[model samples]
Target: MSHDRRRALARHDKDGADRDSGGDSGPDRVEERFLRPFAVAAGDPDGSGPGPGPETLDLLTLVVAARTPGRSEWLRPEREAILRHALRARTVVELAAEVNLPVGQVRAIAGRMIEDGSLQRCGPSRPLARKDILHAVLVGLRSL
Candidate 1:
């Protein structure tokens, strides 16, 4: 990870620690600690520069373990956590929720992992709802 990224993560950790110790509680603190980095990374809060744009991966996109192992030594602690969590099939949102990191940050990290073969993007495959299946069966029975 870059120096700036490391700093941001460190700050995030500190913010979490502070919140745990009852140092700060409110939306302002949450926004400062969580959303500021994204705004800064996007260049401007006003959407002036290149911005985050549409290149960011979808939160619901599924991720799976790659055929090859990643070089853990080359990864940051945060990225290592992400890779470990991805040992099984998980979505980008799932990974973020597991690690308590912002979805955008997780997406960026997962994108790098995909590029370097540490992870693979998988197609979304949620199971069908049981209620929906039963409803369809009932409709079919009525038609019969």
Candidate 2:
């Protein structure tokens, strides 16, 4: 709020002058650094400064655009194999062993699949029990 500082700023603004006005003034130095092209450009690539590359943000936006709610998409190979063994095996532990993955990883993937409507428990939530309807149908067919 000094009279000199206020007058200088008013002069610069009224003249529509670039902040880099031909002098080593304090405001000019500050504006030179802050108004540099790289400072203001979003998604500066080359890792030369802050923020992500344009390509990275663009790819993320594309993925978000592609996602749909409610119905789950078809599985990747790893997800399919994990779901298969989870349904066939007696326990999460058993499924993990069958798939040769850590139990925690198996459980996390299975939980996501179920939440996303891609997989469901065939019977009661407990493992080791054969699905009753499937078992009875198989038994009666064997008699035939």
Candidate 3:
């Protein structure tokens, strides 16, 4: 975390710590109301520049943890919460709901997680078409 982000989180943490005992307490888990619009994104906390690779993420895509996050670098609270829920395969949309963050913000975070190799994306499973089913059976009867 940057100095500014650490200060912001500390200020928010101090303000929030006394009043909200039920909520999780952490730098990354700062309540949405306390965060500036751009601060909600994990990659670019200061929001001075755009973060990388949000292009690959969509709400329907599923993500799962590739491995445990690194203690030194990956300890941000928002990401930790996201990883906890993603221990099982889940869609980006589901992660958003579980984390209590907006879908767009969650998408950005998930995109970074995928980029960093902390999370892996799963392609959406679709039902096979009738023609696809027939194609599989027809291969056994083909004539030379």
Candidate 4:
């Protein structure tokens, strides 16, 4: 395994031990659960490479969170937290920082939320040029 992967696995194991020994509290336990799969995937004990890369989610993309629509439930509390945080307009980076998760993971989670329609991208509604604004002003003056 790569050095970084080994380090991550060690940290994960340490965190797991802490949980088992009751050294960690609520949020820490939640974080550990969220990170465990990433650690295992990184470790790749079978000598396989990392899993397929997640789709790119732009850090600047603005997302607005909403309820999952119907009875569909979130599988992970961490993801639900992410959705909750995104209830207001927030960039992927901001959500990541707020939730203390890696940006890539945040991106993946946001992408999934978007796919499930629990989040909506608040993209630029329109791009108005200075020329367009000036032209509109001139047209209004002519009409008046």
Candidate 5:
């Protein structure tokens, strides 16, 4: 390292513990984006990869938290992350991006969440009017 940079870093370090940037000198930025499927660690029901299959979640399936719980102590870390992102109503793919997991993993976890009543499916992920699909279809093409 250059002498000037080393001395400047040392001075900053001595200023206070609160000012330490943990080796970084700039605002936070996402330096990497990679899948960490191991954290989820699910295999096929018949013992294969965790890749999506029988769970059959369409890429566009909309997911929304069925209801906000006061405390969700029973959910796994992956499930919890999924639910947190679902509160805003996004598709399985979108939720995958939000949680930094693969789309297949998110779909699998989301399907299980739906079955357990932690999440509710309302058809397409887009935020069309009527809120949940339970509301009447007021969009055009009813005449078609």
Candidate 6:
């Protein structure tokens, strides 16, 4: 990767880490840490920029949604929009704005998702969430 690309992605990763430490404390940032590097390496195949391949983006999106703050519901268009666009959403307020929803509603959903196995808490201070499905796979491997 070009130095400029590396730097940009590093910046993105740093930003992601910051978001991981914020509210909602859900699944988004955990997945970003692993996938963003791959996305950067893949480059904009269409010559657009640092975006990853469509498959990768979709995988990461699913992982992000699965790990989302609550419900583990099907990927709603609004939630997908937030993941596709916003990179620094820690609170329901930020997520609501990203997905154009009422903060109360988002908060409820986030809480539900976290309660379900769809998301796992990272730490008390850190607001990171790991997609349970993906995490299960990792756990399975670690056991082997």
- Over 60-125, each residue of candidate 5 has an lDDT whose tens digit, in order, gives 888899876435525456777777788977888989898888887787767766766888888653
Report the lDDT tens digits of candidate 3 across residue range 1-144.
476875676587675444344444543455555733536655545343563445567778889988765573354777888888899899999999998888777887788878778899976477578898688669856852
TM-score of each prediction: 0.47, 0.32, 0.54, 0.47, 0.48, 0.29
Full-model lDDT for every candidate:
0.67, 0.44, 0.72, 0.67, 0.66, 0.42
User: RMSD to the native, candidate 6?
Assistant: 18.0
Summarize candidate 4's per-residue lDDT along 70-141 as a digit string, tens digits.
334334555667777887889889998998887776787676667657778886567579899799899999
Work out how many backbone clashes candidate 2 has: 0
Comparing 2 with 6 on TM-score, the higher-scoring candidate is 2
lDDT of 5 at 111: 75
lDDT of 3 at 73: 37
Q: Which residue ranges in model 4 land beyond 4 Å of their true spot?
A: 1-55, 68-75, 125-144
Badly placed stretches (over 4 Å) of model 1 are: 1-55, 67-70, 124-144
The candidate, 3 or 6, that scores higher on TM-score is 3
Residue 90 of model 6 has an lDDT of 48
**What residue pairs are clashing in model 4?**
none
Q: Please list the residue runs of candidate 5 whose C-alpha ends up more than 4 Å from where it truly belongs after superposition.
A: 1-54, 69-75, 124-144
Please give the lDDT score at residue 56 for candidate 6: 16
Report RMSD (Å) for each prediction in the order shown. Answer: 15.6, 23.7, 18.3, 16.8, 14.0, 18.0
Candidate 2 minimal-lDDT segment of 10 residues: 57-66
Best by lDDT: 3
Lowest lDDT sum, 10 consecutive residues, model 3, at 18-27
How far residue 90's Cα lies from its native spot in candidate 4, in Å, is 0.7
Total backbone clashes of model 1?
A: 0
In angstroms, the error of model 1 at 56 is: 3.4
Per-residue lDDT, model 2, residue 123, is 36
